[model samples]
Target: MNKLIEQQIETLVEPLVSEKGLELVNVEYVKEGAHWYLRLYIDKEGGVDMDDCTDVSHAVSEMLDTKNPIPQAYMLEVSSPGLERPLKKEEDFKRFQGSLVMVHTLSQFQGFKKFSGTLVGLINDEIVLEYENKRVAIPRDLVKKTHLLLDF
Candidate 1:
């Protein structure tokens, strides 16, 4: 049910995002305690601001309300994916090259599931990373999650 709702939302919002030159990062429909939340994470080359959020929110909200896609009510949230955004796509890894990223593997590598450092390269379906003064190649399929890291 949730997946279907997400699909519908994605279909409904694709036009709006493209029209505004924004990238739709992800969408989630989840229940937190008593509240149902439909969260939309968006981004672009220059990053998104509140005005962009507001516009997307208004447009999506109206569309959802009209279609009545979900049987239950949900609070809609449209916003940026943030600096530590998840690297879920190959395009993301390609675009974020040379940036710091943290990756968690499905199984332990070097006796650990988590690895953090610079994303040196992504080639041949593997991610090359430099961490702890050593370079390691991690298979892309092994990564359970990958997120950008903030450097101060």
Candidate 2:
């Protein structure tokens, strides 16, 4: 996946997503086997249905066609983030506080690269978690991914 392209798509699609009363959860531009894919994960307070995905896909597809940001051919996919929702923004940490989450760091922290615990919150550029009955504060800069850990 190209992070740069994903970032660019996020920048371009966020407003349209917001306009449609949705939160743009995540974006990815990746190659799988012989095909390239651009995926957009969106959400709302009540979660989204297939119709929502199709509507957003059409809107986003038209936008991308107008902009032509990616030079190569790729399939566009729009869908919900699912049960294990990603924590991608500061607000997400605050919103999902007290939820179980798995966070992956760019570098090892306390001899480990991943931490799973209850999300305390993001404070002062650090993500605080209650892991194994202890409070662990991880620098946000080092966090590569953070997502809800489904208890089910």
Candidate 3:
């Protein structure tokens, strides 16, 4: 059921995102506590603003009403991924080179579960991280989560 809803949302959002000159980072339909929330993460070269989010939300809401993919009432949210955007794709990694990043590993490395350091580079499907005055090469697949950290 969740997969069906995700598919429908993707179908409905792709066109709107492209028309708005934004990239669809991710779409999630999940039940949190007693409420179901549909979140849409959008991005662009310069980043997204409130107007962009509102526009996408309005367009997506109208389309979802017509499609009727979700059975229950859900609050739809459209917003920027913020300073700590999830590095969900290879393109994101490439796009955010030389930025501070926080990464969690599926398996512990260096006796630590998380690494917060400079994103040195990506080479051959591996992420090179500079941490603790040393360089660590972690397999991209082993990363559970990777997000850009704001310096401020």
Judged by lDDT, which candidate is best? 2
Q: Candidate 3's residue-wise lDDT over 43-96, tens digit each?
A: 998899999999988888898889888889999999998878888678878888
Clashes of 2: 0
lDDT of 1 by residue, 113-141 (tens): 99999998788988888988999889988
Position 149, candidate 2: lDDT: 95
lDDT (CA) for every model shown? Answer: 0.88, 0.94, 0.87
lDDT score for candidate 2 against the true structure: 0.94
Where does the lowest 10-residue lDDT sum fall in candidate 3? Answer: 87-96
Q: In model 1, which runs have C-alpha deviations exceeding 4 angstroms?
A: 1-4
Models 1 onward score TM values of: 0.83, 0.95, 0.82
Residue 108, model 3: lDDT of 90
Worst ten in a row by lDDT for model 2: 1-10
Arrange candidates by TM-score, descending. 2, 1, 3
**RMSD after Cα superposition, model 1:** 2.3
Model 2 residue 10 lDDT score: 98
Candidate 1 at 2: error in angstroms? 4.0
